[model samples]
Target: ISSLRDRITTLNSRPALDPIRIGLFGSSGAGKSTVLNTILGKHFFLPVSGMHTCTSCQVHVSVCKSRYYEAKIFLLSHEEWKEEVKNLLMLVESRHKNDETDNDLEHAIKALKAIYGEGAEEKSYEDLMKTVPEVTIPPSRVITLKKTEAQDLASELDPYIRNQDGVVNSSPQREQMQLWPLIKQVQVTLPPSDLVPEGVIFVDIPGTGDANKKRDEMWKESILQCTSIWIVADVERAIGARAHEIMVQEAINACQVGKCSDITFVVTKMDKIEVEEYVRNHQGAMGNITQHTAILETKRDLKIRKTRALKEKMMLRLPSDAEVLQKQDMVFTVSAKEYWNFTVLTREETEIPKLRDHIRKLYLDMKRNQLHDYLQEILGVFSLVQAYHSTQLSQDPPMRQEELQSCLSGKIEALKAVTTLCFSQMDGLLLKGVQSARNTHKRNIEKILM
Candidate 1:
């Protein structure tokens, strides 16, 4: 019983960052997915280049200093939420490999009937999921429905459905699905970082260039709500002009002063350049990683060199005929080559050794490492979820409140891990800082008082 209480204590503790949700937004080839994949400790999103691919926003439970896997719900207004929800449902259903063909359509029809019930009003999938959190989402069979179905479905499933008839390839629906990925993409999960005590959920908007002026403006409005904004400027292409900045400014201007403070800058592509000073305000970061002066100076040099590299990369793309005002923000130069270095290199898959080899040879981990650090800190935790989801609506249902608290405690152990890593640098300092490993055991004093 005591052990259970202790576990609950650990899991319930609040992480360092604010528990509110967050999103990550930028243009194409911006390493947004790469950044997220690194923080999640999994190679989930496609890191393809040149063209924009991510259409719908994805959400996961991001937790820091907390032990349990965080569970997040992507809430969308009644009329405003359909497309994004459909995208999620499609993906979730796809994971089970359920086809959208005739057979699958039959299956979906069955699913719909099971939840909405016999002689129920003809409702669309959107209508059904909207009731998930309120508990009307029945099993594949019958379920004691409730008013909270939408919230429930939003937590476990994302709805990017195709049609009422389960039509997979309705051209109009397909186009809508295509548009789906670019929707307000939200990531709901424990952030794989440690710096953000509370955790962060990055809502990535679709590429601004891919959307119309109005849509792009909408994207910015969404980004303005995030804890930070990371703009992705291609190293080999346009760095955007003052007009683009105006759009970003317009959205940012509307946000609270504190919200604006959450933004950060990232310049993609380090593998393509060699010169450092042309991009930096300083040349101090170029020493060796092993020497004291070398380590300190090299670290500094690396930072300046990388920032300079980003500026140069962006500058290289600015039209010689076009003058774009520069924005001063911390930038880390990176490359697709470097991105894989940070993520895939650590885990060599049997089938993709070649890709890993290519990224490793280019020495791109330097950039990847910093991005990893930034994400490691901003992961969001699910602290108030139990309060929000107390009643069980499914068989496997949500985690018990006690169990959720235990997960939080488990995550807090990472702080000790980070401290230990730093101590390795200070010789015995890391070891000396550890607490004694002792468990309490009460002694009985029955016959004699000591």
Candidate 2:
């Protein structure tokens, strides 16, 4: 009985399987959101316009087991908000003192306006600090919508996740507050699909070059948690110096520490090429083929050439120590708009389906490994039970009742000692964590005030 109990305890104490997270990264206007939407077969993420992004914080999407589309929005704690506001105020003050460039000032003011109201930066520091307490930050919330109400989820989350275009003030007559500035992250759960399985999480990270220090920390943390990283870029600029710098200088180290072996460089907007201009530029390669055939052949050749060139560039620019960049098929040129519109390119040509297959393969591989581990655990337990029964049957007199009781009592005492030790260790760790957090918070407050 004791042996069986030990086996059961061991099995129960095994950690739960963690979901496989794929982090999506890109510069602003790189169509990272569009790529995610294409892969998921749903327009869940709002695609923004040129030089701007709609995702203000990390947006994690996974398959929901239930019938409803659910969203959980995590809000920044009061201390975090206070620290960020103080930093912004200092930047604004520095700008005023030095008459520096307006870029930093503009960003700080925009963030302040998002949190408070329009013209928030014009106020004095004391006045702005007073409003911080009265701003009434919304608590983290979960919003669920039925399948019929799926279309409304975006609008519901807009205030929390989307970065609005212009400075919009809160209405004085109503209780309307823009919550995007306060949101730390958003988790969206969609109905289960074959393409995206339950244990695969797609994290849409904000642009890597964000000015906010808090956001920069989040980007690094998100990269650390990912099993795979996808870097999205415009097809035309996919191999540009900026893209090279970001991948080689900024992202490679985090990916290495995370032990993420899969890194995909996706160049989007492949269908934006002018066919006639391309054909004219490559007339020697086009030969004397008919116009219709020349166009088709030209597109195929261009895609192949671009894909090869991008892959080579990555291999050369990436450090030789980077295992993630070693794969031959790491680069993909896709057109999300063309895939959805189905105008000129075929579904296969668009490459969205191929990307979906890649994700599905990852999910299937993870599930297989988990299932294997579960089976091994079950077999281990079964062996323990069989050995216990065999030992009992081999006893000459089946053991006296007092002897059996004595054995059980000894096992029970051992278990009690083990449990006590575990609890003690856990309590110590918990107390240590609390003290560390308190010290860090105190230091941050002092720095901001000073």
- TM-score, candidate 1, is 0.38
Q: Which parts of model 2 have CA positions greater than 4 angstroms off?
A: 1-16, 43-47, 118-129, 132-136, 139-148, 167-177, 209-218, 248-251, 287-328, 368-450
Q: Which ten-residue region of model 1 has the weakest summed lDDT?
A: 137-146
Instruction: Write candidate 2's Cα lDDT for 53-146 as tens digits.
Output: 5677788989868777778877778788778788788888888799885655677887787667777878776687787543455453333334
Scored against the true structure, residue 188 in model 2 reaches a CA lDDT of 84
Question: Could you give the C-alpha RMSD of every candidate to the true structure, in order shown?
Answer: 24.7, 18.4
lDDT of each: 0.41, 0.70
Best by TM-score: 2
